[model samples]
Target: MSERTVIPFGPQHPVLPEPIHLDLVMEDERVVQAIPQLGFIHRGLERLVKTRDYMHFVYVTERICGICSFGHSYGYSQTIERLMGIEVPMRAEYLRVIWFELSRIHSHLLWMGLAADSFGYENLFYQCWRLRERVLDIFEKTTGGRVILSACNVGGVNYDIDNSELAGISQIIQKLKRDAKPLIKALVKDRSIKDRLVGSGYLSQEDAVKLSIVGPFARASGVEEDIRMFGVGGYGELAEFKPQTSTQGDNYARVAVRCNELLQSCDIICEMIDKIPDGPICEKPKGNPPEAQGIGRVEQPRGEVVYYVKGNGTRFLERFRIRTPTSQNVAGMVQLLQGCELSEVPLNILTIDPCISCTER
Candidate 1:
């Protein structure tokens, strides 16, 4: 029998955008088991609830992850709204959904670029990000912030897009959809790219269920679990919506699932823009939440994110907790790494789209 070796796979590496360390147990060139080491970027943001008022805490939640900032704020605000029994206007709900979908498109494009870069496709990487800039420009035009848009509040949104601007946004969405097709085709159909991703890290459906994987990672494994199916908020108002899935449960399936979602999000945004009603955006929430617990769930770009808030009948919340998608998907990531070649480890980790900052927070 060959002697076993241990290798450390970085809190710092060229491919990893954030800090995450893994200790890989190896036999020859194959990984036998992979151990994850977290907390490199922990900020203790959850504990800030006591100091910041419940209303102001929306900003804190938004800071948890820049890529999923809108989802975080949306979930936190929904939790506080539920806790206080405040009814947000239907128009506001539709607006929130529009921005949330836009954020999803922005996030998936960013990940696609990174995935392209990992495979040494420099030109493809640049093209992915160039399409993403138009999404950011839409955010800046409407919300006045690109990365951290302070649009969501306790009761509703802070701003509204007029009908004229909404039409312009729809035109931009259509243009983006047309521009992204050939790039996506190249990433999915190119022989060299598929060889690197197709069967590199195989996770069967049974294993995915056993690991409790969430978000696009879980959907890619044939799991039909999505928070939006419950018809929470504006999702119920859509004419039709379904969770995208693939049975392959490999690295390529994950890429395909996210690619499909990018188009789905654009469709959802256009639908909301067409149907949004004209009404007051903000509901002007009054008084503090009664002593009770509130839970909010949103389908973030990575997967499902849950927020738990405890109110003390005061301006200050008793407790605030977030269950980020990355935290839940980490187990499945480790599972995928097992039996993979050492050379394939980085790409396996990237496929899960691990958000270390969100997980650490």
Candidate 2:
């Protein structure tokens, strides 16, 4: 029966990386409702798809989000390849899986650091990002670029890895695993961190599925939906692959999934090197053909990144649509943000790893 108080959360906040203005209606410092205002950085990527050729737009899509750049490029390539009715080489499929998983590891690491920073665990934040820098080095050495490394093509990967490099990668992963395991222990078992995280912003499995959550959000809540397990993007050919599931849908549970996935990605990459067949990395024949409508979906670091491309058998695409994970997860965030204390809002938002740029794109 009491009147509520209103507070403006962002557009410029230390915790939020992008300008996502949220008007929070509060009652006694508890959020009663949240209204999200977006479009601060909407670059009209959907429109650009009409102007740019399918090949060139790969870079554009990669810019959708710095963290999940590989996922965007991979998804776009998959969509175009599907529309063209082209079959990727077996080796290509395995390599794609490897690259995709490695990308996942780095993203999870980056998110972990942000989550730590949000909760005021600055020390943990620095340590996690320091480890992530190693993964970046690996990416630079393998793909020859850092963040938005365009590693995938329409039919296959852009770069190839030789036997010597494969061996080196395996050794590097083994070393990182040792370094990462201890860090994970400190995060999970550290009493101070868990007190701030474990019980806050809880989401039941039913709520997660009902909200149409994707990637780690759904899986962390016990839903077993994964694009890789569906065997769509060369994951089918991989000898080892599995969907990580959990019953607890709290921030702690999400962190566990991400930590384990880091190891899993390293494992997948090492395994692929064993069976990496000898052949071309890509399968672009005589000339790049005209565009056709292609639907490609991949598991981004945050969640699912789907690409819809319509081509008119020309160099440029007729229409391109992308449904980013953050856009889809915002609904879930509204629920998670509600009924929580004002202090916990930043942690909750970081837990979802909100990429406002991707959502607005």
lDDT of 1 by residue, 1-361 (tens): 7999999988999989999999999999999999999989999999999999888999999999899999999999999999998999998999899999999999999999999999899999999999999999999999999999999999999988899999999999999999989988988899989989998788888988888899999999999998988899989999999999999999999999999999999999999988988888889889998899999999999998888999898999999998989998999999998898988988999999999988989
74-130: candidate 2 lDDT, tens digit per residue: 888888887877788877787777777778888888888888888778988898888
In model 2, where is the ten-residue run with the lowest total lDDT?
Answer: 285-294
Runs of candidate 1 exceeding 4 Å displacement = none
Whose TM-score is greatest here?
1
Structural similarity to truth (TM-score) of each candidate: 0.99, 0.95
| Model 2 segments more than 4 A misplaced | 285-292
Estimate every model's Cα lDDT from 0 to 1. Answer: 0.92, 0.83
Candidate 1 RMSD to the real structure: 0.7
Specify the poorest-scoring 10-residue window by lDDT in model 1: 199-208
